[model samples]
Target: MTDPHLDLAARAGVADERALLSAFADNYRAIFRAKVAGLSEADARRSPVRTGTSIGGLLKHLRWMEQAWFQRVLADEPNLPDRPAGEFFPTNEDTVESLLAEYDAQCEISRRIAAAHELSDTGVHHNLGEVTLRWIYVHVIEETARHAGQADIIREQLDGVTGPEI
Candidate 1:
């Protein structure tokens, strides 16, 4: 059967670091989403490992991570509300569809916000003080890539699926 989540967006030309961020981040995001395609709510909530990171929780966490870097830090919007996450399971409102939709929406906002800043543009981070837009992009790419691998493993635990369709 065709997996809709694996249908990744086409990469734009990587003429600069910004384009590179979009391509790599978007690729992993798509692959990560595909990792949990058609998972039951219970299965999505399962945390087989001691770290207590479930596939559904990873989706929620990734969305939150994107907002933390791109929207709150890079865009310098400190007033954005924070979301509390569970150790492994998502909150009651976090269904598979809702999480995916929110993540995609955040991606759109990230694209728009990222284009407005220069690589050297600076923002105040809560923990790290001042940081550059370049730093945020690099941080996000690494964070997303790590979670993508985690999602791949968790998805395999949920079902027998291994290796991303993307």
Candidate 2:
């Protein structure tokens, strides 16, 4: 499928806050989404890197992080159901389609929250004390980008495919 996010990210360059934010989000999105491209249902879930960081698991982790930071923390919604981190972890039951669906849901929820708030809006974090919505966005962007980098390395190690060049 065509990921509008990729296009969106492409439009965002490393300039100002808006562009920077979009760039961060885009890198994160690209890392996970790109890793699964051209892989089978089985290969996508395989921890071929031996680090338990399967492409599926990475997608689930990003989803969990978005919900945790944006929805659960910022909006103060109740924690995401009984889903332990394990649900997102790759097991024999995880499929490429299922992981992508979960990621899409997370992306929708996150985009809604992000659209409604400014980066300056503040929320009380139990650990970090008061944090601005801007911080969360950047934090997620940075964190996601880092993981995406990891995914790039892992994907290459698994199959010889690598880099943004595709």
Candidate 3:
């Protein structure tokens, strides 16, 4: 049987920096999404941790992050919706399926935006000033991986599921 987990080493072996970073970013995205798979709506919205970081909330936050970096920052689209007041907590209308679908759509938009620019191309960040596509890729990878690990722990707490597999 084929091994299901992403092979980071294989991804790292790619010579192109863009490809390598995109691979890692996409891998962590998949891992985070898998962590929330098969969870009931109640479980997905449960805040087991003190900080109240639910799986659904993570999905929503990450979806916004993708739009912030790729659409607003890179694509120069200034009219994106503001983040909800709860930030990491999903609203009552946000089901797990809807959150996941929105996340997937945002990720696709991110990929398209990234593909249009070279790694060295720069975008003006709201706080950081000018930033390169390379920096964005690395930042997103770190952010996604960090949250993915958090999701892993939360999923394990919820149903004893561990790792990135669905």
Please state every model's RMSD to the true fold in angstroms.
2.9, 2.7, 2.3
Best by lDDT: 3
Error of 3 at 9 (Å): 6.0
In each prediction, how many residue pairs overlap at the backbone (N, C-alpha, C within less than 3 A)? 0, 1, 0
- Better candidate number, 1 or 3, judged by TM-score: 3
Ranking by TM-score: 3, 1, 2
Please tell me which model should have the higher lDDT, number 2 or number 3. Answer: 3
Candidate scoring better on TM-score of 1 and 2: 1
lDDT of 2 at 64: 80
lDDT of 3 by residue, 1-166 (tens): 3334366536578457888888788878888887877899999898789989888888899999999898888788877898777869888889999999999999999999999999998888889999988999999998998889888888889999886442
Tens digits of lDDT, candidate 2, 1-166:
6555665565665577856685667656765677667767666777766567776777777878888788877777874664464854776766778777777788778878877888788777779988888888888888777777777877787788875632
Instruction: After superposing candidate 2 on the true structure, give the runs of residues whose Cα lies further than 4 Å from its correct spot.
Output: 1-4, 7-10, 14-16, 163-166
Off by over 4 Å in 3: 1-5, 8-12
lDDT for position 76 in model 3: 87
> Cα RMSD (Å) between model 2 and the true structure?
2.7
lDDT of each: 0.77, 0.73, 0.85
How many residue pairs clash in model 2? 1
lDDT of 1 by residue, 1-166 (tens): 6444343334445346666666666677777767777888888889888988888888888888888888888887867877674623588877888888988898788878888989889888889999998888788878877888888887787787776743
